[model samples]
Target: MTATTPPAVSMLAPARPRRPRAARVLLAAACAAVFLWPVVMVAVGAFRTSLPGTPGGWTVTKLVDTYLSPVTYQVLAQTVFFAVSVTVVSTLLALFFAWVVARTDTPLRRLVTPMMGLVLAMPPLFFAISWGMLGNQRVGLLNTVYQWLTGAGHGFFNVESWFGLILVSSLKAASFSYFLLLGPFLTMDRSLEEASLTAGAGRARTFFRVQLPLLTPAISGAAFLTMLAFLEAFDIPEIIGIPAGIRVLPTQIYSHINATYGGQYAEASSLAMCLMLIILALVAVRARLLGGREFTTVSGKSYRLERWKLGRARWLGTGGILGYGLLALVLPLAQLYLGSLQSLFGRYDGFSLDNYAAVLDDAEITGAIRDTALLAVLGGLVTVVVCTGLAAVLRTRGGLAERLVTISVWMPMALPGIVLGLGIMWSFLSVPGLNQLYATIWILLVGLFIGAVPVGMRAAEGALAQIPRDLEEAARIGGASRVRAFAGVVVPLIVPSLLSGWLLVAIMISGNLAIPVLLASPTSQTVSVEVLKLYQSGEISQAAAVFCVISTAMAAVGVVVGVVRAVLSRRTLLRGTG
Candidate 1:
């Protein structure tokens, strides 16, 4: 009789909900629209007869006319050459320094790490301005010092030349590659190199035959990323190349946008399309090189990093590193600090606090400081949240949907900031209701959000990959909903990574000039834009003063982040020990 009744159903049984495919699809589409709409608008504008504000229809006149021009070809060629030169030099320099620091017992190796961090902390625009001040032929501090030491009538170094441009750009580019390569160099399996050495290979042979071959993936990846970075970079070429009468694609696009008589927005869009195509081609090649290969260097095993003892040559390595720091960090910072105190840029005409006082007192500068703070904080927060969600979906849901989301999020990394700015300008101005935001700080925030999402997403994805899904699943099994499980188990674990991504985006937005330059109204001006304007107007002392303020603020933020990181790391260590 009891068996015939069929046991009472248990109301506490766990329920497994199906994945929300439609919602994920909708999210993917929404993200794609947010990220890709601007670029699509630029493409549409490029073929149009006039700018967004003007009355015109679609036409290929601008594209055909631009392609037919000889200057366009020249500029394109120069841009490729410049990018390639910087990539090669920077990658090689980074490889050398990374090797010295990670593999060898180089003196001051620990110091070199923090020095590189400082170098990265300094903005590229700041580098451009500082070097411009230091290497000016007439009144540059470096030139003056060189003249003083060598008794030369004319200055030996001119930052306005192509050589100077390449040097500064390579220095900046090297920092990026250095950071990228350092991780690989540090965690690489020493067993492979040891095997090579045990098999009768000398040190050089081991490096070339075994070590370098194993690192081909990292090296090539770094090189390609550096190339992409150089192609998108506008600060170096804009500040140094303009004065030297040297034109590249990015600078050419900028010139078209800022022409005396109302400028050519359509033409700028056309040029941006060309630049975008070139970048797409590079990306295709990079993809082909990276695909269908196993570049894994680590496994589920413990390993020790064998550091080479370079007793005598340690000093030589130390000297080379310090020399690089002198050029890349010490010299520029020293010049910037000294320039800030001077009444004039090059002349140390009896140092005074006047420039700092003037810069601090200016309403525009003060406003810029406040606006940049808001942009950094708000933009960074929005980007981190959005990118974290996108990354989580992409990581957990691997399929066509995930791939689409990944591509959409990363698309902005390929576009130059100025190009992105131009696209946003067109997108907002062409839209009926969105046009109201064209000159507002909101546009800048949105543009920066788009620009920074890739970085934040990548960081988040890496952090998420390290965490196990079992933790969330266990919570789900213990009668918790999916969202509750994720919130309770995942977010707390990834807080450090989230903080890192936020800090990175904040730093990037604070220093970014290209996005703000075109999008900002007078009321929305940022420190980067103001610094550029001041430098362009020949107010070198005032610009230097502003740069000092910005740099100091950035350094303070960096210090705070460093301290927090250290504290968190100690806590993590204690937890591990306990």
Candidate 2:
């Protein structure tokens, strides 16, 4: 009998065979084509004289026309000013809240942590519509209260103005910045603060001289990130800025592409080029200078965090924290819920379920709800899988190849939502084979996956990084193939982070408006798109009704996910002990 060789088992990673090998190759190509190609196409579209779908040679005429226009400079100035204002105010607020939560013995501080997360997840459209109705000059809730209480003839606030725009966007920026800074604050060693205190510094003095300085890098990075976010902000800008006659770059892009007739796709592409120039510069500073460089005071050794005594001041700090929670989340949600019940906004006619009935009974709206739910759950899973695969592939390589992979994974960071949507739309329309996917739900799915890669990968990398490389190597040494080792060893270890990341992606996808606004067909309409249409068409109460349903569902899903994670964790512990 012929001697039979052992079946394949320990194939090296780069030469892995059959299904796993094909998957790795397909994923890598998809990562490149999805993230990198669209931006390149945007650049191509900028110079191409033809509109998005037609054939034409490249030229600089559109680019020059865009730059030469006075409106271009005006929009640029306003965008910079708006972004800077939000960044500064939000960063300061985030810093204060982060400190309050991490170092001080403030009452109910632990609760503030989750409050910020919920605020961060709540859609920008939620804030925009809720605040819009609340701050309406004529027949708004706030105005009605003001008139009743203060005997004022007219309400002072108009949400269609710059002040309203800044307030809504700043609240969101602060919540997100606080979330990013919180992790660093919680993990930071307190040795420097202790040393400063022992060296005759008062608590206030130590906080400024030591703690603040130690946190400078993290704070600066958060500030920059916040600026980048406000730059790309679409839902708030479109809902508020457009009505105010304010033109941020994103709104400009939207207006151009959705203009009269066939629209100025080329002009919009040129505008996108301008926005991308700024974002790409910021992304370089963030990814290259700060990426992977730990700015923490110390790491790898556990240190007890000594909480600062608040004396009689705990109540003040706690109240402040709770007040922000109320403002950031509770107020908007309450106003939204109230609006949904109101027969008409600003009137105290007996509450009715009329608006909810109208929203829920609409065929289009029901379809949108189903689409949003599917995209959030299924699109979120697909994105997590793609990102996790990319992370796994990169972990096996080093130097230039890994750097290229890193850059590709984060490519979405350099493109604003409107711009990316434009690119993806134009890309699908331009490419022959891809044209088949255009105007379909699948296109929006692609956008969500690519849009979510940066976030999903960060969570995956953090979880994966915590595991020792030797553990995977041990599995390999025991004759497991790379695929088996990764599946059996790595995935089980990172389940919690994977699930957390998956939830984040889902929340983002459900709330995301810009990408879907550009990409969705009537059949593929998402809740966000429908919400915008409802709000725009003066169905104010109906819009609120739609949003309230989505918000409640998201909260329920989040709670279920938290319970599952907790149960899985407990079972793992129990099994290990047994």
Predicted model with the maximum lDDT = 1
Scored against the true structure, residue 212 in model 1 reaches a CA lDDT of 78
Pull out the clashing pairs in model 1.
none
List model 2 lDDT by residue over 1-578, tens digit each. Answer: 99998767544434434345555566657667878899989888888877777777888888899999999999999999899999988998898888888889988988877888777877898788888888888877777788899998999788888888888888888988998788778877887777787899998898787777777778988898888888988988888888899899999998998889888888898889999999878867777866676555765655767788889998998888878877678878888998999987776778999998998889999999998899989988988887787788788765454566787889897678888898898889898898988878889898887887788898788878977888887887777998899999888878877899999889889888989999999888999999999999998999999988887787789899999988877876675579
RMSD of each: 3.4, 4.8
Task: List model 1 lDDT by residue over 120-192, tens digit each.
Answer: 8788999998899888998898889888899999888899999999999998888889998999999888887
Give candidate 2 regions above 4 Å deviation. Answer: 1-29, 188-191, 197-202, 284-296, 299-304, 312-315
lDDT of each: 0.86, 0.84
Q: Which residue runs does candidate 1 get wrong by more than 4 Å?
A: 1-13, 194-200, 295-304, 561-578
